[model samples]
Target chain A: MYGGGYIHDDQKKKPEMQAEDPVLLAEFEARIARGEKIEPRDWMPADYRRQLIRMIEQHAHSEIIGALPEGTWITRAPGFRRKLALMAKVQDEVGHAQLLYSAAETLGKSREDMINDLINGKSKYSNVFNYPAKTWADVAVIGFLIDAAAIVNQVANSKGSYGPYCRALERICYEESFHLKQGHSVFVYLATGTPTQRAMVQDALNRWWQPIMHFFGPSDKMSQHTETLMRWKVKMASNDDMRQQFLSMYVPKIWEIGLTLPDPNLKKNPETNQWEFTEPDWNEFYEVIKGNGPCNAERLAVRRASEERGAWVRAALKRADQHYVTPLA
Target chain B: MNIQSLDPRITRLGIDAEEKNPDQTLQREEHWETYQVFHQKKRGEKHSSVGVVHAPNAEMALLFAKEQYARRGETVNLWIVNTRDVLAMNYDDYDVFSTTPEKMYRDPAGYKVNDKIAAYKKAQLDV
Candidate 1:
């Protein structure tokens, strides 16, 4: 059992000497142990660099696209304060994407290339973002629960092996604190408001609950990537462990607000010191990841429309550069 | 001196010296090249660089910067400058400062204040 209190039932393999030059591997491991951040110009394994680029770029894309769902409700917010909060939250997501993309660029990928990949649908973002934010309550639930789930994962990533990613997460985590509070406040208001407001809140919670559970990824047993991720210290915690942390922290909060979680089977077990919850439909999770979610088509279409609309702005900049000339005598 | 009606003259050096080129006459339109964003969190604080945004003009740049950077209610003042207009020291000219020894005297630790503090503490105890 680890200090986090989860026993590793899986067998541990003996640490084999890396097949690469022994001296270099020793140096790499020594740096990691010393808590020294690996900068862009520093030497790293090709696989390490590739993995960081892929992960960071996808995270950036998610933030950029993730703005769309909640951005739809900014105008419809019931009060001036709510509207301002929604706008600020969406704007923060955009800023976060810029910071993340800048970090990914440290890995040698160009912003243009990553943006192209996202536009052409060659890249994947967090699957939770594909679902539509149908109502103002949905926005509240997303901020409260979806953002909360993201905060849990991001808090772990703040300790990521990549230095820039960790640094960027510092700012991101601070902003997310405000977001989580705003979300919780909105949900509380609705939960305590008129029957219609309470019903809307409940409906949003029901729709978002399963997706939140699935946000931690598939179970540890099925995660083939976990072993390598752990070996490299890229992912310090297992998927199941992160999921358990989310449930334990959040399930009670949901109940405290006088709302029921969608999973009737969910309860804390005294013996196991763990929450027993109905397993989310993994098939649906996979389906969403594969672009079969309810709002996948609509989300992609909206992104494409925005990109197309902004084409003129890019073209105008390019043309403006052509007009520059040195003053002549 | 008729300006537009002046006869074109070729200089002895064989250059077109007299003809004013219409291409040169029309001043190039200057577009907003870049914006430097500053954020002030409170009323009395100095604004600091949050980041920069590229735009077509100052007005557009300010709008974009507000939307992109200050949407979080974090800015009270913003300054936008054309990227080309900002004069910066060239790295090629940076060799002038290379001859000086590393300035250790400017560091607070270089003063060795710990000994002074200890001596003062001992005097007070003696008193």
Candidate 2:
């Protein structure tokens, strides 16, 4: 999955990258303008490398942390089919983490450092995952809606200018399509089931609606650095555009399934061909990202506990002949 | 899920019951062998390297690879090769990969066919 679509301005320490040659920078920009992908070995502006490392590292962190909520439901899934499907689905999320981490690693950060930053709360992930998946139906909502939103972002980013990231997203988007089907099937099953089941799903949808709205993030007009990011293809679609796309595509589908959205202002504008909705509570979004959300502490604690528990596994995998070498900055 | 362990000497849990058994050390899932995955999209297509999966055996490797690499109807066949078994030439010997002579003629572009074909078509049309 993708991050919450935030390009954070405040990383604790920004690398003091030296100025790139203006001619080289111009050439690089022209290459991007010409739609040429920048490979790992290519010379780049320091800001580009710094921005991509943050963006892709956050994406990778989101995938693994994103796995936790759904991963918890793997065993408790209602039946054999669901259990197996969820297992594969959650496993795919972890695999996406591996793919994304490798892609980010090509930018020069080790997966270990990324994880360390994640564990220490020095980096960020999608804010949606900080919320709890309280029930089985929450799984259905998250799997379907969250995965759908991610596909929207990923499909756009797959065409981005970074070669390894684009290649990885190509594969990731392919897998996510199948994940969408599984998620949609589960959502349909729960939605069309008995009255109790229907209510269960509806409640889950209500709980998740705000988070889903917050998923694309606060409107792009609120973002300041987006213009340059867009030029570089690092931020492919603006937050508003992606939100509009998701609403246009999925709002009708949700209604067709006999589910109602919690939003009173949600409607499509005929003249503008845009979705008009109540602005999501950006205050709550900020609160969640600042470690004040209902599940943020718990999520990070669980991650810390998991790393401690899994230390032996990683240790056992280390070769006896090799010493640990830290990755380049 | 209640299946027995495949090893005859081990208990159903796949652990030796004897306290002194050397195999009773830390049992971590990381010990699983790495398998390189190659996927063929169609019957006649060439198999291409997709990625890798870690599994205890070949069967498990194939099973893991299906959902990991082939879940989206992306492949008709998959090959899982244990990573340890792969032999490789060092990059220091990268010189061996190229021949000293240029092979420009290997490409049809070498034949300078565009001018010839255009002139021939032009001549035919003129006639």
> Model 2 clash tally?
0
**Which pairs in model 2 have colliding backbones?**
none
What's candidate 1's DockQ score?
0.04
How would you encode candidate 1's per-residue C-alpha lDDT over A1-329 as one tens digit per residue?
A: 00111112213442332356667767776777787767665667766776677778878877887887777777668999998888888888988887776677667765656766676666778878778777889988988888887888888877867787787787788888899999999999999999999999999999988878778776776355556655566676777888788888887888997998788899889999888888989899778766798766555555554555566665565544533211110
- Give Cα distance to truth, residue B7, candidate 1, Å: 67
What tens digits encode model 2's per-residue C-alpha lDDT throughout A142-249? 889999999999989988989888878888887788788988898999999999999999999999999999998877673455677788889899888898999998
Q: Residue A42 error for model 1, in Å?
A: 1.4
Clash numbers, per candidate: 1, 0
Q: What is the lDDT of candidate 1?
A: 0.69
Model 2, runs deviating above 4 Å: A11-18, A222-224, A323-329, B1-47, B51-106, B112-127
Instruction: For candidate 1, give the lDDT of residue A123.
Output: 70
